[model samples]
Target chain A: MLGYIIRRVVAAILVVIISSMFVFAIFFLGPTNAAAVICNQNGRCTQERQALLEHSLGLDQNVVPAYGEFAKGVFVGRTISTGPGAHYDCSAPCLGISYVTKEEVTELLKDKYPATLSVALVGGVVYLFLGCTLGILAAKWRGTTTDKLLVGSSLIVSSIPYYLVALLAWLFLVNEFNLFPKTGYFPITDDPVKWASGLLLPWLVLGVANSPQYARFGRGSMVETMSEDFIRTASAKGLPRNKVLFKHGLRAAIVPIITIFGLDLAALLAGTVFTEKIFDIDGIGKWGLEAIPVDLPVIAATVLVGAVLVVAANLIVDILYSFLDPRVRLA
Target chain B: MTEVLHAREPQPEALPTSDSDPFLVVENLTVQFPTHDGLVQAVSDLTYCVGLGQTLGIVGESGSGKSVSSMAVLGLHDEKRTRMTGSIRIAGKEVVGASDQAMRRIRGKEAAMIFQDPLTALHPFYTIGAQIVEAYRLHNHVNKKTAKQRAVEMLDLVGIPQPDRRVDDYPHQFSGGCGNAR
Candidate 1:
């Protein structure tokens, strides 16, 4: 088991490295000029000024060496010179200075990440519990009217675009009706009450919007599990209907749900662009979205972060699978 | 050679004696399922009886209502989907059209079923010990530790070696025969 985990961790690291290299290669070697972007932002880009910016940003070097420098910067601290006499001491794991913001990319990510984490974690829990409960209830009722109603409602909810739902929720609940408190992110440490209340609306919207799929997934898995021979054995053993459904049935049913959940939560943590934007929360998603076509460094950093999260999530799901299903051996 | 020949020869069917009393009786039992296409008669007019300490072996091709009939005896069929008629009495208790609560009391206590495929019949997530303990504790008034001990004894009784340690192993860890014993 320890060997299996070590192998998985190594594979995850390799995936992250390859993805980061891909992101760097795209931004550095692509048609878009990193130095030119900064130069154009400052003023009219003369040839000399562009050359000077390129040299300072290390863009003048070959792609291989430039990538090497960037990778090295992520480990040891590197001095980023935007121009002559304008050097910024970017600490270790530096993602470089944002061309537009002039702030360290790592600092910007650190500041915005908590808001995303707060939204994702709270919303994730709400959706998982609500979705799985509804699903299990639907499966228990199986062919009844209640089951039909739950399945039909989930289909209807999932049919609509997610962004539209979030937008309408924000527009009415916060803007028009005064139903919910004003939606924004506040640091939990500063004020826990404000944090909860401020994030309540977004959490609800995210939970409600995403839960329909989870409900369907859970329902389908449970239905299949209920038909397994073990379930029949459980029933024959005189276990109550509730025990048959929950204990014997749900344990096996939840494996697939967890797999889906791990990826979804990782994606959410990477940054909920629509949720953050619609709710006016300053998260990594909004920052990355704003960085497009303007701030190259911030975009690269967000991509790298997203790749790391997805790889980590996949590894976690695989490990979790071994626990949930004994038949699945990691080796 | 003469004795072997006599054994190979077909003998006349033996009739039930007056002293034998049947414990389970199924009379004119018909089970149907309504589907999108039409009604499916899974089992029709099935009549059978089994006396105490007697074994009745049911053999038929797949989808021939063999499993369906046995499941009906235990009231394991989905009440909502299945249409059952006639009478099924297990130890003099009527099973056909019986309420779920009545069936619950009878199941595992009065009668229990062993599924055909032992590999799939055992719950995969739980250890053999846990599954056995669960079944034992359901009808028997005993603590988990006692029930577990009983489970170990039962496993040992079934010719399973290392019953104490093997009880903790999951169904997939056991061989096909071991799983059936479990």
Candidate 2:
């Protein structure tokens, strides 16, 4: 088991490295000029000024060597300059200085990540629990009016696009009706109540928008599990109805649900662009979205972080599969 | 019209005791299921009885209600989906329309079923010991450790080799014959 985990971890690291390189190459070596964008932002970009900015930012070098410098900056601190006498000491693990803000990309990510994590974790839990419970209940009353109602409602909700739902929720709930508190990111340490109230709308919108898919997945998995012979065996063993449904049936049914959940949560953690944008939360998703066509380093950092999260979530799910099903031997 | 099937006659010498009363009696039991297509009469007017210490062999072609009637004996059919009629008395307790609570007391305590296909009948995710422990713990007020010990003992009693080690193995890990023994 230990050997299997070690191998997975090594493979995950390689995947992250390759994906980071891809992110770097795409943005830095693409048609868009990183130095020119920064120069044009400051003032009219003369040829001399663009060349000076490119040389200072190390964009003038060959792609491989420039990428090497960027990768090295992630491990050890590097000196960054916007123009002459504008040198900034970016600490170790620096992603790069943002073209617009001139702030270290790592520092900006650190500031934005908490909001994204908070929204993702709370909303993820709410949806997972609500969705699975609804699905299980539907499965228990399979072929009944109640089951039809639950399944139909989930389908109706999922049919509508997610962004529209979030937008309508924000417009009515916060703006017109004045039902929920105005949405924004607030540090929990400063004021816990404000933090929760500020985030409550986004959390609910996310949960409501995303839960229908999970409900469908859960219902499908549970219906299949209910037909397994072991379920009959459990019933014959005189286990109480609830125990047989949840312990024996759900224990197996939840394995597939968890696999989907891991990936979904990983995506959310990477960034919830629509939720953050609609709700006005200053999360990584909003930051990354805003960085497009402006801040190349910020975009690269977000993509790199997202790639790492997805790979890590996949590894975690595989490990969890072994624990959930004894038949799944890691070796 | 439903046709009655004959039960194989038991040898007099094979009787454990000369008691005349049958332990299980089913009279005019019918099992039907309502589906999208139509009503499925899985079993109709099934009458049979088996005495204590006597073996009853039910033989028929596929889809001949053999398994359906047996499942009916334990009231295993879904209450909402299935329609059952007549009387099924196990050890003198009527099971045809018994409440779930009453059936729960009888099942796994007074009577238990060994399914035909052991491979799928045993849960794939749980170890053999855990499945046995679940069945044992349902009726008995024993802790998990004690129930697990009994499971190992039961495995050994069934002539399974390395009962202690193999008890922790999943159903798929066991061979066909071993799974059947479990």
Candidate 3:
């Protein structure tokens, strides 16, 4: 088991490295010139200024050498020359300075990441619990009015566009009804109450929007699980009705649901662009969106971060699968 | 004179037979499904009886309602999808149209079924020991340790080696031939 985990971890690191390289390559090959972007940020983009910008940003060098510098920056610390002799010391695992803000990309990401994580974590828990509960209820009450109502409602909700639902939530729940306070992000350390209130709307919007999909998945898998022979065996064991549905049936149904949940949660953590944008939260998602075109370094960092998050989530899911399903042998 | 005599005479109620009967009896059981195509008859007018200490082997070809009939005996079929007629009695207790609560009381404790495929019959997420323990704990008033002991005893009874150690193992850890039975 230890060997298997080690092998998996190694493979996950390799995937992150390869994906980061791809993101780096794409940034260099793209139409937008990093040097021009930097020069443009200075309120002027003359040819002389562009050339100077290219030299300072080290973009004038070949792509290979530039990539080498980036790679070195990740392993050891690198000094970033703002202009002439002015330099800033960027610590290890540096992602370079943003061309627009001249701030360390890593530092910026660190500042903004907590908000995104808060939204995703809270929203993920709500949706998973709500979806699975509704699904289990539907499955246990199959063919009854309650089952039909839940399934129908889930189908209807899933059929609608997610962005629209989020938009509607903001419009009615926050703006019109004044059900929740103004949507924004506040650091929890500063004021816990403000932090909770500020993020409540986004959590609801994101959780409710994502729940229908989970509900549908849960219902389908649950229906299938109910028909499994083990379910019958469990029923035949004279287990209570609740135990048959929850213990035996729902346990099997949760595997596929968790797989979907891992990927969804990872994506949300990396960036919830719509949720953050609609709610005006200064999260990593909003930051990444704003950085595009003007800041290649931040965009590249976001890509690498996204890849790492996805890989990590998948690894967690695989480990969880082994625990949930004894039939699956990791080795 | 006849009317006066009838008024004085008392009647003996002819109640259904009690106590002296087979352990399980299925009489004129018919199961049918109405699909979009048509009404498909799975089992037609099937009748069978099993006494205590009797083993009945239901032999039939594929699609001949062998599994269907047995599943009906356990009340495993989906009530919404299939139409069932007639009666299934277990030790003189009516199985057909029994409430879910009643079925739960009688199912594993009074009558149980050994499924055809062990691989599919056993829950993959649970260890064989945990599954067996759960089954035993459901019908019996036993704690975790006692339930586990019962599980081990059951495993040993099924010819599994090292029942104490094997109780910790999962279904995948067992060989293919160890068909799951309870």
TM-scores, one per candidate: 0.92, 0.92, 0.91
lDDT of 2 at A42: 61
Top-DockQ structure, candidate number:
2
Task: Report the CA-based lDDT of candidate 1 relative to the real structure.
Answer: 0.88
How do the candidates rank by DockQ, highest first?
2, 3, 1
Query: How would you encode candidate 2's per-residue C-alpha lDDT over A262-286 as one tens digit per residue?
Result: 9999999999999999999999999
Q: Chain B TM-score for each model? A: 0.86, 0.85, 0.88
- Show model 2 residue runs off by greater than 4 Å: B1-20
Each prediction's whole-model lDDT (CA): 0.88, 0.87, 0.83
User: Please, what are the lDDT tens digits per residue for candidate 1 over residues B55-151?
Assistant: 9998999999998999999999997687777777777777776667778877888888988778799999999999999988989999999999999
Question: Which lDDT tens digits does candidate 3 get at residues A1-331?
Answer: 7888899999999999898888887877778887886777668689998888888887787877888888889899799887766798999899999888889988999999989888889988989988888888887788889999988898888888878988898899899999999899999999989999999988887777778788778988999998888888887777876888888888889889999999989998898888898898988888888888657789888888899999999999998888877777799
* DockQ of each model vs. true complex: 0.63, 0.68, 0.66
In model 2, pairs of residues that clash are none
In order, what is each prediction's RMSD in angstroms? 8.1, 5.0, 5.8
